[model samples]
Target chain A: MSGIVLPRRQLIARAGGLVAAAGALPLLSGCDAINEAPAVRKILSMGEEMHRASQRALTDRDALAREFTRADLSPVFRPNGTRLPEGEAYAAHAARGFADWRVAVTGLVARPLSLSMADIRAMPQRSQITRHDCVEGWSAIGEWTGVQLSRVLAAAGLKDSARYIVFRCADRIGDADYYESCDLVDALHPQTILAWALNRQLLPIANGAPLRLRIERQLGYKHAKYLSAIEAVASLDGIGAGKGGYWEDRVDYEWYAGI
Target chain B: MTDLPPAMPPVRVYRHRLPTRLWHWLNALTLLVLLMSGLMIFNAHPRLYWGQYGANHDRAWLEIGSTRDAGYLRVGSWKVDTTGVLGRWTDGEGATQRWAFPSWATIPTRYSLADGRRWHLSFAWLLAIALTLYMLWTAFGGHLAKDLHVRRGEWAPRHIWRDIKDHARLRFPAGEAAARYNILQKLSYIGVIFVVLPLMIFTGLAMSPGFNATAPWLIDLFGGRQSARSIHFIAAWALVAFFLVHIAMVLLAGPVNEVRSMITGWFRLPPAKGERA
Candidate 1:
């Protein structure tokens, strides 16, 4: 009952510490409006604990959210983000049918690769009828076929030092560029893919065309569109804003935006 | 005046009731939990963009990224590492493992997505019920509208301005309930109780699969499912920020007297002379 410690502070020599005594009395009243109610705080803490527990419980990349059937596709699969890249570089790539397009896989790797659109298409592929969960609150189910990200990682070879995978993009939001990332587990996930086509067609400009990541297990933002390059890194510290992604850097988006 | 017969006080003018006390304090506590847990959840997948409330190429309602689900998939043994650590459950004697992500900032997940779904949904129910009951009782019993309703006096521009000034000073003025609550308190309480919480609850339901069909109006209200998700997260952050600041204020304003009134439903007073209420 007696175990209590309160840090004491001086009101200071700056100005009048005036009426410090009156303030002291309310300090004695527990559950004063100034203080958080214990139960609510407990719930808040509990919520945090639950989240921590969830993190501790789930981590294997192999276990995937069940893939749905083709009938599950939304009547209207609204596209999110830039429908089409605006800049000359993107326009040039778009014009060429992205045939000459190349995706560079560098940064902390054994042997970095610069793969062409054809090269990516040639890799053994898998398709899943899954939902595209956009941050904006709509979901569209589409059958996406592409090379398993794990296979590409195996070929490009990630170094031990690499802890994060960054996707450099060709799209820009406002002034900053579009980039996103994931950790090794997510990076190595079997369902994680870089799809060049959506619903049996080369993805249109509205839906991350030519090449866009369909990180099936995650929300859409992690699926960096307008694919330009990918980098693997040890820590997110040195990257843009040291947080890992483009939106994360400019806006306040969290680094590990796992769904 | 007491010498005559010390007449029994003419029916107690005001007495603190335990139920009211419990409701108030519980409300306070639950809000705190909701905010923190909400923040931890947001931190796990921090990304927001502005646009129309739809499933269009522009705006989004929610963003259920890999982190939200994958972050919670840790199984059996979970560990935290320097870079960051998360989990996964191995089934069939490690022959197979499902669910995995790497992160520390995320609110801790308890199990696979299914488990998370159960826990989160259940807790959401708990909050929904508690708030609902509290609101109903307060409304029917005339407790909330009577005690907390912003009056003409409170709404008066001068008083409101004064409260704003006092708040800017980061100190309540010397008066009844000045230390207790002033105009600003009403604003926040009203914001949360009347506005934010409902938005939170409704948006949550809007994103939920069970409610999508039953409540089509909700879906139309926020544009789409993803938009609801975004609103949910952003609004969550706002509440979390409110809570952190609120807790810091409690520590600053003196937690004892504050806690006591909510706990005991009584305040050893300075009377209206000094008390701001």
Candidate 2:
């Protein structure tokens, strides 16, 4: 009698385990289903907007990211995403120390200027030792030297209609050139610079040599490297996939990558 | 045969409050999503370090990576092969995948940092807001003072030791005594609610570059951004440990009664040992 009862109980327990496993399969798939739902995605995206809004409301417009001393700088600031641009144009520019490369300032600007590397160097320069926080959760501190993007915009005389500043980079990943955008507030911030030097030396080729955007408050992806052009626009509606940045367009990365 | 004596009816009591029950379930869902998605995020960079800066060249205190044929986890000088479970694993599609965490353990059940962030940040708001409201309720709504407060005598070494010994022996409080939290339960609950949860929230905020600008002191308080990140990872595991023990305790104490109390706020008390009902 005892043996018969024990076997039946064991069978019941095994059946229960099977039922649990079956239930778990649906639950996992349900998570995927909920993730794919468009309405749910929209709600999730609101968190990004809320984060941006709350951060803006809490901090001063000109609030600075923490700057580290030289001693705190990483021995090697790891170069990420498009270390080197392809094709003869970038190669030729690199061969010549980028002396001939020009960063065109166009779109909604009173002065549509084509500034050479020399022209950027002649402008007022600011050097800052700051931490570069990557979206992938690594950080590196480096000293960057460049002309403030605000100073460049001032030189170009931004039109009243201009609400956004778009950065065009020489590096192309997949079909289109790497690009990024920012609102006028970030564009005009004192720490927003077009850095041409790193670690008090000419920026390495792998590290977006010649020129790169240093939007200090944002993540690494927002700092467009190997800059080719800067455009002032009223809206990001006509930009690449209308998301204001390449990764933002392709991978659903938040445009305001402050976090 | 003589007729069996009538058995005693179990005593039922309203144990968990509405706020506690609601927050407990909400937190369960929120924390699960947060942990899973957080693992996916960690897959992007499966290394951790200390101080202000840490990158590929800098020495990582912890790393999970693959080399040719083997997947390994390294913590300081110690290393272990974690091939099938972590660093490398086979996905649902029967393809070998190398990532810090397995696909089943991540949300969307695949690798997508963007989607992971979406789920994490969305639930984070729910967690933060719910935690704030729950903490306020616990503080001013009399939940803390009445239900969780330890009497002066409960703090005595003898009393605390007795409770610990009882737990070790699996000798749970019975009858009316089971309704109130013991000193250990009260202390652990207080530690989790007031200390660990808040630490998780703050450390998470500290990792954000944007928030760092607004509250640089947070980084300073945690030693550095990377240090804050390490602490965040450690605290996440601490929570996982807490959850495992919590589930085990529920199962041991009587899962049906414990779960029903959480869900419906009514618990049936177990009768005292050697007592004739």
Which structure among the candidates has the greatest lDDT? 2
* lDDT by residue (tens digit), candidate 2, B137-225: 99999999998888999999999999999988999999889989989899989988999989999999999988888789999999998
- DockQ scores of the candidates: 0.05, 0.35
Clashes of 1: 104
Model 2's DockQ? 0.35
TM-score of 1: 0.50
User: Candidate 2 overall Cα lDDT vs. reference?
Assistant: 0.87
Q: How does candidate 2 fare on TM-score?
A: 0.94
Highest-scoring model, TM-score = 2
Off by over 4 Å in 2: A1-27, B1-6, B274-276
User: Chain B of model 2: TM-score?
Assistant: 0.96
Each model's iRMS: 14.7, 8.3
lDDT of 1: 0.58
Report lDDT (Cα) of residue A250, candidate 2: 69
